[model samples]
Target: MSRRWNPVHPNVTGMLHGGDYNPDQWLDYPHIIDEDFRLMKLASANTFSVNIFGWSAIEPEEGVYRFEWLDSIMDRVAEQGGHIILATPSGARPAWMSEKYPEVLRVEANRVRNLHGVRHNHCFTSPIYRQKTQEMNRKLAERYKEHPALIMWHISNEYGGWCHCDLCQEAFRGWLKNKYDHDLDKLNHAWWTGFWSHRYSSWSQIESPAPHGENQVHGMNLDWQRFVTDQTIDFYQNEIVPLRELTPHIPVTTNFMGNYPHMRPFTGLNYEKFAKHVDVVTWDCYPPWHNDWQSTASLAKDVGFVNDLYRSLKDGQPFLIMECTPSLVNWHEVNKAKRAGMHKLSSIQSIAHGSDSILYFQWRKGRGASEKFHGAVVDHVGHEHTRVFRDVAEVGQVLNQLAPVVGSSMDAKVAIVYDWETDWAIADAQGFGKETKQYAATCQEHYRVFWERGIPVDVITPDKPLDGYKLVIAPMLYMVREGYAAKVESFVHSGGYFVATYATGMVNETDLVNLEGSPGPLKKVLGIWAEEIDTLYPAESRELVMTGGARYEAKDYVELIHLETAEALASFTSDFYKDKPALTVNRLGEGKAFYIASRNETSFQDDLYERLLDELQIGAPFPVQAGKGVSVQVRTDGKTDYVFVMNFTEEQQTVGWPGRSGLANLLTGEHVGEQLELEPYGAVVLSQSRE
Candidate 1:
């Protein structure tokens, strides 16, 4: 009988580990191959991602295929009781192909065509590239579908980066035709091309937006961003369909860069749109780099937020950590190494947020290449005794011991609403003195308050189902889609607490402002009108005195509101709008909607969060106040709870774990009391044993 994994895929072994094993780099000595099998066996690893960047190696000259070497690697892995994640080497076209069809190369905004060197610099619009990629995928599938080692199909590595060649521009026109139904007038209006005489009389009048530079029309910029994202998704769709037809049982997925805005060419990556094409969601986890000048606590928090974001993309289904550094990375200005015990901590962190597999970028370090210095499973010493190697082996052993974690899921009562369209619209806009740089910062501030207070929140798109969540927050929500206001109204009137900060419901889906009034669709539910928006100097601060005797220092953007049905909870104490409502609440049915018109101090936010939870009659799921630096996350196998307690700080600290007084850790089989001490970067999985 064939085995099945959660999210509807096959898994013939215990929780998958290992990644990107490019044995082709070590092909000089057959003994190296034998040694790899020995090391993988010693490490208890069962999965290997192969052919990640093997385009030239697999198809060197013309259509002459050379997968026999790959076949040998696949057989060797299978004989050693391992499975393969077969990757299509389409991320980079072979040098010969790129040399032949320069149209396949990427073109920058200045029209400088990129040379045939780096990966992900391929033109997304090249039909030749797409056709060759699809053919390669089809061949890879047919060749390995029956092989016992083949378990999954990886389409390409990190599928993004924009191109500006004429073919791509022509392809953009075709995509626009489909999007706008070939109506130039509608396109013109939607793009708001009247400004700067950008209106198109014919379909051929348009070109890539970056040439006009950053100061182009805002609506055009937003639409062009959406168009570029669509091009990437279209390429993925074409590649995946062929693979599915060839290997009916195999699941297909491509790794993502986990929504780090500005990493890709544009600021419009709709992760939700890409999630629909794959059987399982896979994302690379390389948190923002920190030098000696900065700290990594924020990095850990970012990982937590993104892990939940990707998990929410699959509707709480477990995803995979497709690429993470074994120790340090090479891209940043200062590449920082993972501290001792962080390997286990990071892996568990991913698993706690619903990742079934934890994999690395490559299995072994290279002798000479662009990424030779990057972290790898086998270091320069080429031995199993390295510190990083021990960590990798220990992680595999721990995963094998915790096999029951497979198929486990997590649920949250709080939801934070975010959208790529909203991000793009705000980023594209310039007239508002209220800046776009602080949009994500505003959301993260609210999320951090909850994180510090031990309140787990699911970062969700606005269109997600709101049936179960008690509190729904849309922070810096500037563009509210059609029917979304009605959805919020219904959710509030039906007893769900709704919280929106400044800039909520200001525009429609088309990046067009709601001329009716500010705070457009949510005005009725929020029961207030944004009379005016103002921004203060960075160092300047204002005061907000709440009804309950707490005073908060407010800063940045402020919306002076004229209330209708809303009752003032907090009033500003400075400026011409002194004593005006800064925070207002409106009661609907048994629920209430609170609108915060300005960013406030951290202490104020903490106090505000507690009051909201109290008013909503909701409490933390577990005793998350287990002291500082401790994170308590819980996941269930539907019936039993497996709680992960981790210490992110450097000093040893004792904290309380949720549930009965004492429980046995599955790893050590030792009974952990309610109060247990975790050393710096230590983590433990406490298994719940029910009566």
Candidate 2:
């Protein structure tokens, strides 16, 4: 089922083309401000996010409010017929507030209080911080609630970090008490504190996981992470009270951060639960494009996978790229500028998945700061003559031309479960090698096949309803939350194709291992039981010989499976467990469930899913044979389908286009032929009217 994309602002139509604008930085220089508006018009940018990280600018001292600077910027935007996404400046507190209210400072896990310096360092449980933020938000809402330029509420700039202060420790205790029904016995059972005689007689003994204190207890660590997420959400809710009261019509959203240092999703907070609090979802996407570690196409699939996950957060609603670098960010180990035409290609690719906007991090580069070298539309020279500016303007033109694609969504028939809780459990597990876990990356490998074949897949959580999906995939699902196994059983029983991988069903939500064999609750439905799992080393490898005489390579991990009602489709051809079942399939009521007992190469997944795709009759949106680096995705209004064909490679490629009659390129207003040639990093948008 395809869900219609909800617009973030009713009055602001078309794709949002602007980004984070810091006009407050230039309040002293009016000439620079004058040039920004001229450049905005030239770039065809319409929306700007303002007041993020502006605590000091808005309030220089305690209660010394300065609304004139903000007022002028809002008025200037309104005068230019642009929208301003006003943000709450609580991400960082002013130095004055930090000095006066030392309680706002966060204490580290080892009990080292942080000095007043960086951002996202405020303690979430501080009542003084919450009160001050609420008061500031109230004033802003009262001033801008009626302003025509105001569009959406940018909650806070990337809400993350944790506070192990005394206040937060007490809050965690209260949270645990409420969760365990105020019973120490239940809490002890859940935490399994009987081991090592760590049973807590009182709540005061329990504290957030600390390196020097209690890091070995998995349950405590898991609960501590959950508590931090809840605490952060609580603080965010406090900041939005005034906005919800004054500007109910405007939607509210906070920019979510993607995974750092690797290709995994952000693990600091569980976005699945936090997504429910926002009216619309938005996130910062800074994939390391053109990196040496991976191919352009391979990295593109990763970006697509994360974008798909973000889109599925709101059930297929179009999300916004709140803060992406237009050129290159200064933070990476090597900050490399985007190649020519890569910006437009990447921007359109975001829209192809489900993004409605292509907003950047900073509109103009900062003069002197940590992010001064970060990419921006206007360089430090402050002109629109640069190559980056031209690329951005080109994207703006394309967005304006593709206005009808706004509020359109993907109709995906497949869903891949990417559970955050499962990821945390797998990472925190004691046995397996941390390098081989790759929970998020493993899911990405499964998704790569679908992405390559142009089959839309919703990267969903385990709890999301599986009613509309024809096929569901769960990779490395080590932790099965309550009732998820039952949900999978019901899905398979109702004629849905279910696929799961190794290291699945090992534990419960609290990192408690299920007793009666592996895949404990799932055994009845899957018709297979795992006796033991062999964790292979980095250089180890094995062969999986299928029953059909096809052989494939397996590595990293393998599970010994005892078939109950299922038949082995493939078996291992090496090691002490030679000829053991490596892959098995079971036929339940109306559907079949397949389990891969070992980690195989991408070739194996490609072969397996190709058969499944044919068996399930799931194909591309249109009958097109896209080249290796070319990708095709579809969005629809039910009466019309917006097809985005993108070339992610550096060479010219020709796609065997789906030459449907009356299908015309939406960007060029020209009809596409049977064979379409795409230049390096090129893209084409076609619209086909179903009516």
Candidate 3:
């Protein structure tokens, strides 16, 4: 059951189709509540998440308890054969609690204690806050452990931010001491504190990085990041102790945040390590679709790459899209509405990767908050006669039609490494020109080539096994941990294709330079020596001239390489390193390893991967040859195949659906022919039974 998409609740089957519902916001308007139930039926949403930020309403006073309102909402959902994802309401503490205990508030990095006005601003290390959260969770579990509507336990909303208070400082020191085996010398060596005489004379001297104090120790910064993540997870584990004890059957999870403003990964905390504590993985996806800087198809590829990353976190298990806006978000610089048919297309795109459900951030928008204008299922108008509401209804209908896609999973033969530790190390590096690092963006660029070709790719961390994948690509892997080089060597020696870009294997886990060479531990496997890395200005670019006479543009970074056992496939055609090897390949055994010594244009990657696709005998998931802006993805339920074909462009696209007869179009309940024509922002789910 864990291999596929496990059901959220036994009573409610099919794709989960509801979102964060805050009935507490409209408690006084009984008519609004009545209309919400009516519209819920119209949208075919069977699940509703309640009490996400309802702490103030649940516990208005320090010791006073109020659950009659929540009880009514739970009973009503059950009466209508729906499910409730009950939240513990720890995302925001009650005003009374904060007023009673000042320690509950977080301390900023500048050592200023916060005045607790916003959500996710509580001290994760505060004993009083932990005690209060456990008490609330226990009370909720005691009341609704056996309730028919109670399905899942949403522990907290978007767990992020860190505290630098005295409590947290003590905890961090303890963590470091434990990691270093209670030896000050080991801590000093690991943190490389001798460089600036910042070595700790006492444990009390070590504190979280600060602007006015200390931030130059890369090792300390890295450890601080790890400590914050551990502390956050430790706190989450504390919140769920009661839920695990009382309602062991209910799955517990907290929604994870995706990339922020400019498609950068959320660097606040490491979700990879935190994902192990939860039963299922879920994330909030809000891509800036149809933006002026990028094409719709390009944006779709980015979303696809991220969805695959989340799906791969659970080993390809069907995860849930906990929160996504139906139209436009109020937080963007320009809140542009979603174009016609895009809502359904984007929703299906999630399912195509490995999502079992497409849920929104809010069921209904609030009236007087910062997010009042944020897109929701029901806007401030309080009716179902809106454009965004109709799009939600349409997505719900499509989810209903493609029920078989639920609990399905994707099997990919390609694996791309996107290690968070490597990213953290790269981000903390003082060199490499801050604007040009773009670690996540580089991985996405490589991933897009495979995505456009409909080649299923698993975005994995550096530690994951590479047993099944034919090709393993690790782009911008600046930090090579212990034994990882041996792992790559063995993988390539055993006839597996390996690809690594520039800036890989430069340093150890402690942020110290690997004296073995520029590529350090990986030099032997990569069959090349990176003598120097040259960072180019934004306006500067070099030409990568292949041996086959194909010229492509290379930019951002260029590595001077001296071959060991590899032969040059491409060379630079400009500057002092003109005609030097820009790309090389080494035949280890039955397979080969390719090293790209510089960053190149997307056109170069597209051409290179297309050739690799044929050489490896890997083809698209579907048999159809799709046109430009058309994306084809596939998922399997172990007995059947579900192919999702979507057109992400503003113009119509066609796909040559060869020899795919008698396949049922699950959305329309019709048989497909040899050719399928898709309109702008259109999508179709084709299901075929296995032999």
Candidate 4:
């Protein structure tokens, strides 16, 4: 199956744009409020998410519900030809509930209950909190079911956090018992609990991983991570099922954090698990705010991967970039401004990948409080005559021209495996180098080669069927859960090329080392077995001498391996492991499986991948003569191809004519010939003739 997704568009008669619009905040200031509509109209925004965090206003006290203010806001948006992504104010517990029912507040890992001032710190497992939010959701759906502006139901704001309180611990024990069939021995053996005499005598003996007592228990930590994720999903399902029954016409969704692999401080959410419950897959994306806006090339690739990953979640359909910034963000250590064209570049990149809509966090900057300084469509200047506003206007104009790409998807023949379990397990196994470095960077290093070559790659999990992808890359995948090794074997044996890098298949799903041999389960399919491993300290380097007379440097770590039924593609030439195989290729059923024993230099990866791709007869999505900081992505309706070429840098660049020449630039309507030049952060969407 190529892809199957049921994408429903509610309240959106056209392309969905706009974002969190808080008219209730300015109910007193009619003059300043009048300008919000004017600015929205200028920006070409059509949707507004209303009443997101108005729980305090919705239900000021127990059993008292208010809706006059929200009713007015809804009617106002309806009159202005805008749709509403009506939100349930469940993300943050109301101050009254937190103060009265203190158990609703989450207890931190340090054993202190969080105060009422913060958002997203609610104990979701609390019955009182659940009852209050249930009533809020029921009332909102009852009132807005007939509202003309109601198109989508936003369940809660970016739901991911954990509560380590006793109540949650009881729930965790219950979860573990149900999963383990109430067999303590099975649970203990799976977690290797007896290694440190930590075996549980009873269900109550199982505790949350956030507590310092079990901080080093890798298996328990992974399970707790999974438990919290399921808890959050269950919470969302409880809210969504009823909303769908009430307002069945409207689609429901919750915003997911795009920094998904690291949203672990709380619920440890895996978007794949949550995607099915929502009508649309949406996430909040913020690239590194550490003042690295020089080119944003690498960050843009991450953006593309996330967008494609979201698209893949619903089986290759369009998703939403629900919350992004038009410019700088306030949460950074030192808030920095996004260079002029960067905002527009980021938005288009999301669209080019697979996003159907672009919505910002807030329409206007907050006047006071923590996020008051955050970037907004309408800045604190009280007017729309600003540089950010102008840049936003340009993006809106471009989006209006992009109605063709509304439901189309980026065509991908390559996929990079992304498993939340592996990602979480790798965090517990972070002593491979001199210091604890994130395994995510190594995963992205593999993604970078294809990204640079304009080759589209989807981020897939082990559960997803690999029927369509010609090539699959799994790097830094340390944990091989049950049945996953079989999945990898099936993909390669079915004539699909596979690549497995260092640290892959070294541990089981339980975070236990494979006692057989390194890459234990996959050793058979991969035809390689590792004897010992060596971690490269900072500044230490090893060389890999390839059979083709090409030499590449391996750094960060090295795995000394001996091949069984595979040929050594390259061998190490350093330390006591001299002449050992560094890279091996095995001829499987009808295809080839390549094993990279260590992290290699970028140039080496690029060179090796180019040869492998050439041998496999795979090519870039499109041919472009653009330089660095330039990227190309292709999407299609299986009839007309949409080609997106973008300049990620702040300097002007030119690209020669593509391989197939009958292309018309969608922006300028110019038939590209010889060369096309783009200004700083310039982007061009072209329609390539399929025939």
Candidate 5:
């Protein structure tokens, strides 16, 4: 018999109805505290994430404790019938700690040791820092073990960034020892240190790799990044393991930065290792302001993909959308407010993709800070009069009315492989590709084709199983880690359709290239030998014509390759490389591997991707209608599926809900027998009660 799939968070079980609540920052304390509870009640919010940035307030001095204020806050929230996801307050260490223990300060890539000012300033490998953080965690856990308000344990806030201190260098050596057993031979082999005379004769000879030194080596600096990630994970485990012993029943987690490029959360810090101590996986998702509708849809799919990855890693336990800005963020140069209905639609999209809870970055607006101007449920005026507040309240009301229809819905048939480690290796490679060859952007382009047609997609990694997906796209797979190529091979050999692009399978786990070919371990399975690579300057492009009479524009990193046992699908039509195969398809065992050798324009990419999907007989969840600014996504629980139709246009635009039969509008409580339409800036959750 298989193991039972436990709910994501057993206590705060149903669709998590909560937002970030920082009452500690308010000076009115008691009066404002009461008002916050009232506002939460009005918004139908039952959960609160507290103590995220309260380290300085809680621990003012060395070994000094001040839980009295927090004690009152927690008790009051519980009295008001709200559940609390208590954070460990390690995100921003107190200024005193940094001043006293300078070792806690982080040294950047340029070897500059930062002074105590910003959050996420401490070095993960600092012994003093780790000890102090662990001490704080123990005290917090011991005090809140049986607290009635406690629902979940939130370990440090958004665990990221790397430190290049001397302590980290020592720690990196130990990490290397454990990984390679202190064998210099294996270490040299893995790093391919021979070409640059970088072979290490002894364990003590190694130093923290930095790109700033006189003899800066990118390969070594990249591995040090991998080292720092492991160190951070170790720090989290130290805190979590002890906390679990005290409160095993309560779930524990740390907020992950979704699709983060640096720190490689997926690889550097082992999710599986941390998942054992964690009950649910949560991430902070902030999409760019300049992104179009397609980008938003792609991001929504990534949120689900990440949740699904965490769920699969944690044995199918649902994950949470820990933090999403309600509206505009502080950083973007021109932060545009999310179009009317887009916020609510995005929330539903999270649920459709496997998020058990929907939470925002902030509940009430900050009076003064870097995020003071950031959008929130309640603005500076502190009332529901603001447009954001009104919109939030409206969403809250809808959530209450259509609770059953919007909660815990899951729908996905195709899964795209997203590996942060592979991304890091490629991005950090000395001479691999251009810095703009972003993994997220590459995968997003492929995902947009499905998202525009309301197709559900799962973003997964190579380690995760590919049992259910009909098509799997792995873009910019630079570093093929251990066993990943085997997994991809197995999936393809079992009659699955796999797609990969340029700069894939170039290196091993340690950034070492496999001399056999560009794809390394995947060469045999992909059936292609890349001989050389060509990088084009901006505005330069090559025309590619498909064998079936489809023409497209291609640019960026183009790989010149020879088909060993594959058929050419498309050929280049420019320069000396004219008529050369630009796209090839190989018959691997019982499956198929499609290889794209150049980055193509979005229109061309969509056409090629759609053609492949058409050939595979994989139908979209809905039909595509001709219209700009209209986006759709499908979410299902294997039976009752929902098609989220949203329009991001200023002018009124009509959108047809394709293949939607016998559907009911979850938002307005109206039933539809066949097709449904949406208006400008209007959104509707069309549910098919019967599959």
Candidate 6:
């Protein structure tokens, strides 16, 4: 039987409503409070993510407690019929705490300690920092455990970044000791420390990877990244244990940054381990409007991928969209306002993924802070007459009409493994590829092809089981972790089709290359051996002629390999490496493994992915060529299916329904038969016809 996601909170109806509400920051508390609640009602907002970044207000002094402000705020919100997702005020530590305990301040990669004023400045390894954070969380959870409005426990604000303080150094040594089992010889072997007279006789000799230091080692810096990720996870688990003890029923989670580079959300910290402690996995997604529409759609699909990551970790639990910018973001220099209807369309896109709730970064504009100019439901103007306000209200009304239609929708079976650790290792590699060739961009390129066709795809880790997916694509996977090759082999042996690209399986988890050969462990499964790597300079290009006589162009980082038993699918067709196998396929056991030796343009990659999908008999949510700029995604809860078709382009596009003759637009409550047309930036939520 397949899995399903259903929220237990009574006030959270079918669809999640409400957003981040910070009434504490507003000066005219009484008037603004009334207006905020009024706006929520007008927008049909139901969930209030409160207490975010309110440490100073809650615990002004070292130990003096003050919950009067929060007390009043929660009481009023509860009275207005709202559910609360209370956040632990750890993101923004108070100025006094930082000034008093300077050790809590985080040291950057350059060894400079940041002063308190800005958020995310606390060191994860700082004892005092953890103590204060835990104390604050304990107090907040104890005080609000039985609060009628309480529904979920949000621990910390978007957990990210790393620390390079003495504490972190000590912690890193301890982590390495455990990982290498205190065997200095193995540690030296893994990091190749003997090359630079860096062999460690004592674990204490190992220091934090600081960019400002003399003789910086990439291997050390790489390990430090992994160590910092583990430290942050430890901090989260520490806080979560106590919070769970207080309110076991309420789910606990910290907001994760989607595709965050620094944290490598998938590995090191082990999202699977983190998921065990977290009840509901939530993430913040804010793709600037200037990014490509296909990229944005791919990001929307990635939300489900993240959810699937958490689900796979926790045995299939639903995830939530904790924070998304409703309007213009303050971070970007030229923050363009989301085009009309684009906001609602994007919000539905999140829901189409496994998002149980959609919440914004802030409900009201900050009066004075780094995020003061950030987008909000109620802008700094303080009235509901603004364009953003009107759009928010319109979205709210649409949610009211479409509440029951798309409350609990699920997606497809195809999963693509996207490993951030592999990305990091690939980026940090010394040789074998061009510096400009990025793993994330390459993986995203492959995933975009499926996303554009409304084919549901999950960005997963290589360690994840591949029982359900028809095809698993792992691009630029440079690091091959322990037992992963065997798992991939097993998946392939079970009639699965796996595709891998160049620069894969070259290194171990420690960032050390496997000296045996290129594509180390994966070579057996691929039935090919990479003899030499051909690095192409900028503007250099090669052509790949498919078996069907279709030719595609390629550039940057081409691998010249010898096919042992694999059949050549495409040849290099350029350079001294001409006539070589640029692409190969090996029939291994009951499955097959395909290898692409170079990076190709979007058209080639898309055609390749589409052909694979066709061979696997994977079906998309909508018909091909329904519209050019319009994208469709389908989610279901067994009984009903909600199809979200969005027009991301500036020009209007028309979409056609082949099987269904008539459907009701959940957003507008309009009836349409067979075919429908959408304006620029328009969106339509179509439910399975009741008739």
Top model by TM-score, which number? Answer: 2
User: Which of the predicted structures, 4 or 5, would earn the higher lDDT when compared with the native?
Assistant: 4
Clashes of 2: 0
Give the winner by TM-score: 2 or 4: 2
- The TM-score values for the models, in the order shown, are 0.95, 0.98, 0.98, 0.96, 0.90, 0.93
lDDT per residue as tens, model 2, 1-691: 6545667887778999899998878888899999999999999999999999898999998889999989998999999899999999998889998889999999998999999998999999999999999999999999999999998999978988899999999999999999889999988988899878989999999888888655578898889889988998999999999999988998999999889645567888999999999988899988888888889998899999999999999888889999898889898888888998889988999999888898999999988878888999999989998999999999999999889998989889999999988877777786887678888999999999998888898999976999889999998888877888889889999999999888888887777889977787888778899988889998988999989999998888988888999889999987876988999999998899999999998899999999998998999886577679788889887878898888989899887665465568888888777767889999888888877
Candidate 1 TM-score, true structure as reference: 0.95
Tens-digit lDDT string for candidate 1 (473-581): 8998999888888989989999999999878777777777788776898889999988777777788889999898789888887778889899999999989789899
Q: Give one digit per residue, the lDDT tens place, for model 3 in 1-691.
A: 1135667667757998999999999999989999999999999998888999999898899879889999999999999998898998999987788788999999999999999688998999999999999999999999999999998999889999899999999999999889989899988988888886898889989989997644489998889999999999999999999999999999999998877565655778887898888888888888888788989998898888888888888788778899999998988787888998988999999989888888888899889879888889998888999998999999999999988788888878899999888888898886797899999999999998888888889998877788888888999899998888888888888878899989988988888888887788888888898888889999999999999999999899998999998999999998877888999998987788899999999899988888887898888867678777788898986678898989999988887777768888999999988777889999888888776
Give Cα-based local distance difference scores for all models.
Answer: 0.79, 0.89, 0.88, 0.79, 0.72, 0.75
Which 10-residue window of candidate 6 scores lowest in summed lDDT? 260-269
Model 5 per-residue lDDT tens digits across residues 1-691: 0122345445544466767878778846577667777788777777788899888778888878778888887897788777889998878889888788999999987888999888888888787877887788888889999988898988988887888788887888888888788788888777667866888899888887656542345456566766766677788887776688888888888987654422123444545445565667777766553354434434544544455455455434457778887788776656778866677766765555556676887998888878889877777787667777667777766666555543334445677777767666666665744566766667766776776666666667666778877788888888787787788888888988888888888877877777887888888778897877788878778888999988988877777888888889998988767788899899988889989988898887778767777877777665546376566665555566566666655556655545655667877888875544555456777766542
Model 2 stretches astray by more than 4 angstroms: 213-215, 658-662
TM-score of 4: 0.96
lDDT of 4 by residue, 373-392 (tens): 89888999978799888877
How many clashes (backbone N, Cα, C below 3 Å) per candidate?
A: 0, 0, 0, 1, 0, 3
Off by over 4 Å in 6: 8-10, 212-216, 259-273, 291-316, 405-411, 432-435, 689-691
* Best candidate according to lDDT: 2
Error of 2 at 379 (Å): 0.6
Clash number for model 1? 0
lDDT of 1: 0.79
